[model samples]
Target: MATLESFLKDAAQGDLVPWSSQVLAAQRFDLSLATVEGTILYLDLLPARYQRNRNMISIKQQRRLFNSHAVVIGCGGLGGYVLEQLARLGVGRITAVDPDTFEEHNLNRQLLSSPRLLGHAKVEVAASRITDINPAVTVVPVLAAFGEDNGVEIVAGADVVVDAVDNVPARFALANICGAAGIPLVHGAIAGWYGHVATQYPGDTTLQKIYSRFKNGKGVESELGNPSFTPGVAASFQVAEACKVLIEEGDALRHRKLHLNLLDMEVVDVPF
Candidate 1:
């Protein structure tokens, strides 16, 4: 079994370039490809895998990100992109929960959804995709709806839970579960050209406080329809908030909502 240390010394790329495919495949030993990537990242070798992350994220911060756990509930437009960034950013472990299967309607915004994946489970697809992107990331795919029965256990060990679910009731349920578990929750949603993101810590009723007024059965997305660009924009902000929570960096969206309107090209911060 060729270890990352020996492989690095032997190849001695001396820069950020990744080792040849042959070296990676040969020295991988019993570890999964992701494990190999993780080992290189753990040593702060840069390995081309995370070279761009340098300067932007100190090696210390990268290490912190590599050790964090995030549970994302939903595998649609927002969840798919959130998971993609988390995996690429080397979030150590991710638990993705979603019961829905990919469908034609999701092709526009869901990164893991495609015509060939129409009937496949969304969480499973996300897990497979993450492994392909960054072998160092451990992704746990849970094919179940976020609800009262399994909500707590699903989010139990997570440092942060991302609320990418589309419906109002499901979002509230996830927030309650995360709050009770003392975990931070990053919430995001998009409808047409509009989107919003917020961060809620334990004991915060931000979601309930904001959505309680909307007695409507569902989110505005149903009527307005979610386009490809809206979720992409919103998910980027959601990932930023999640990373901030994970690495304890930057001012978070806690107790505040960032409203984005692509049509009007406006951004506003509203205190909750």
Candidate 2:
């Protein structure tokens, strides 16, 4: 019986494995495509989809991403973009958590929302989109809100979590759960032409310090009424931070916030 790793190593073309070879290997071994892709990474062969990620992401980091599990706590504005980037960037497993169905209002800033998808559940749509983008990535669409009832179980084994929920209380709930679970949380928020990205590690009180004044409100997004570009900008930063955590590389946004004013095309560092 030929082993999966041996097959992938033999099928590689100078440190890169084409997608066709990956597909053939999966079929030959009776394995899921994701399993085959993981084996390719384990053997230090870059998948064709991630060929461009080379020189920035090394073979070791790509393998780490293939084996990583990430949880995105909201599938609305920020989360939709976060999920999109994570899958494209080759995170192997993702858990998308969002309970709401898309509505007309979401069309303004939500990446996965469309006139055709109105009233469709966000997580399901997200899962389908992720699959369409990267079949090697497994998406677990949880059609439930992130709260005490399911937060711990939802984030179990995650290398990192992204905060894309709309409300301040929900953000705190997610932060608390991640703190208890020893998982890092990449926090992102958007308000009109503004957005911010920060990272919170377990035992850190950064999120508490940031949202303490908001109380029960969902932040200034209600007043600002986010523009279409804000979530994309914020999610870009969030995804980069999340990737840093997963790869255990780079200067992650821990204890500091990267604030953006797209209205003026300016970036400001807000340190905590």
Candidate 3:
């Protein structure tokens, strides 16, 4: 087995680019006549060996994710982390929707915003950051509210949907869209030291059921009440589960919910 490091050292002796058939075949370690011809013509376009290894893992799995589309309904605390992770993992296309603009307070956890981005649209900031992270990723930014009017179209084109939005109405709307689309929706919510995440698919655990416990009470109003670390931890888990669902890898949190208590440093996975 040729190691990626050695192959990169050898390839570095020449020019290389990505996505060319030659680079694709060579990265796959296939030296057939077809691959040979492609390589001969575009050998200078091959991706560096490290990138090849990082990007091309089990051609079947890579193709599955590369052909999939994901929609993230919030580009705030959780959505920012989810978008960044998904882009890095090589998800083919991403649609980011958010109606808010970056503010000074967001600098605490929002990865896409900086001092310069204050007052700029969240989707624009996230789209630019996503492009910088992975130019190959196709990012669509929609600066609109995810409601009944746009929910169907927003969820229709996605293979998977992520609910990182802050409010209940938006989360419920996205969940409904995912259910209607028959796609899996990875859901996450944060408040103070507590946070929760779940994977809900049509005909499976719905966000309505998971959030039933809080319907009777008035939810937290001030975003300021949410501590900095809460969204980070919850968003990380949400992104992980979303990737698992996208890749069809290990078991996901479908039909189950995960609760985290940062104050006590505890986690519990409960069957829904």
Candidate 4:
């Protein structure tokens, strides 16, 4: 390992060529270079491997993750991807609620779904996948659906709530609980090539209002008939929006909805 002072001294004295090889080799433990006519000759260059070893998120940001907790409802296509991103980002704690099982159709977009996990409960499968990605993340899987009865308690301790459910009733239930708790709710929905995302605070334009008009008297249904790449895109936005809320960053999607039409590659942000 080369010290910073020595490295700087070598650079200032025009000895960087010799120092570079020692620094790279000592730090990476894998490189060897020869010199020919005062020019460096490299027998091998593994940029990807070297980059991976050096890749790291800052400690300050990693500590921020330990201060937050998020709840994700429905471990399907959108929820699956959302969980994966959140866990990868090192969110301290996560509570995932769903009362369904992984099916063959879900493999297309559900991050945790696979042929091997075909009949497993969605929450269980998702939790297993999240733990594999980041053992540091505390994933609590609730093998029960989120309803008025359990919504309030489930969301009370969370700093942010992510709604990736497919049902209008469930969305309304989660929105009501989060609103009462004064927690920011990250909402995402997908239908075919179109998807919508919004960050709603208590008393702001509630999800119930939006779904009431859109669903009318009909029951909730999956628009994609079968899972596809659309939910992955939408869920990614939801995770990003949730993280922004958690970190208290400026200019969140608060009181606004982002609509995307993947077919035409158009996006529109509508304010409430």
Against the true structure, whose TM-score is highest?
A: 2
In lDDT terms, which candidate is top? 2
Q: Which whole-number lDDT from 0 to 100 does residue 50 have in model 4?
A: 24
| TM-score, structure 3 vs. true | 0.79
How would you encode candidate 2's per-residue C-alpha lDDT over 101-206 as one tens digit per residue? 9999999889999999999999999999999989999999999988888888999999999999988888888999999999999999888888888999998988
Give the Å shift of residue 142 in candidate 3.
0.4
Return the candidate ranking by lDDT, descending: 2, 1, 3, 4
TM-score ranking, high to low: 2, 1, 3, 4
Candidate 2: Cα lDDT at 270: 83
Q: Can you tell me which runs of candidate 3 are displaced by over 4 Å?
A: 1-57, 213-218, 221-224
Give lDDT per model, in order.
Answer: 0.83, 0.90, 0.75, 0.72
RMSD of each: 2.2, 1.4, 7.1, 10.3
- Among residues 3 or more apart in sequence or in different chains, the pairs in candidate 1 whose N, CA or C atoms overlap within 3 Å are 34-135, 34-136
Residues 1-272 of candidate 1 have per-residue lDDT tens digits of 56556775555466443746424643556556555555665665655667788877877787788778999999899998999999988798999999999889888778889898889999999989998887667889999999989999999889989998988888878888888899999999888989999999999888787787887676677789988889889999999999999989899997889999999999999889
- Please give the lDDT score at residue 12 for candidate 4: 35
TM-score of each: 0.91, 0.96, 0.79, 0.76
Candidate 4 structure, TM-score to reference: 0.76
Lowest summed lDDT over 10 consecutive residues: which window, candidate 4? 34-43
lDDT of 1: 0.83
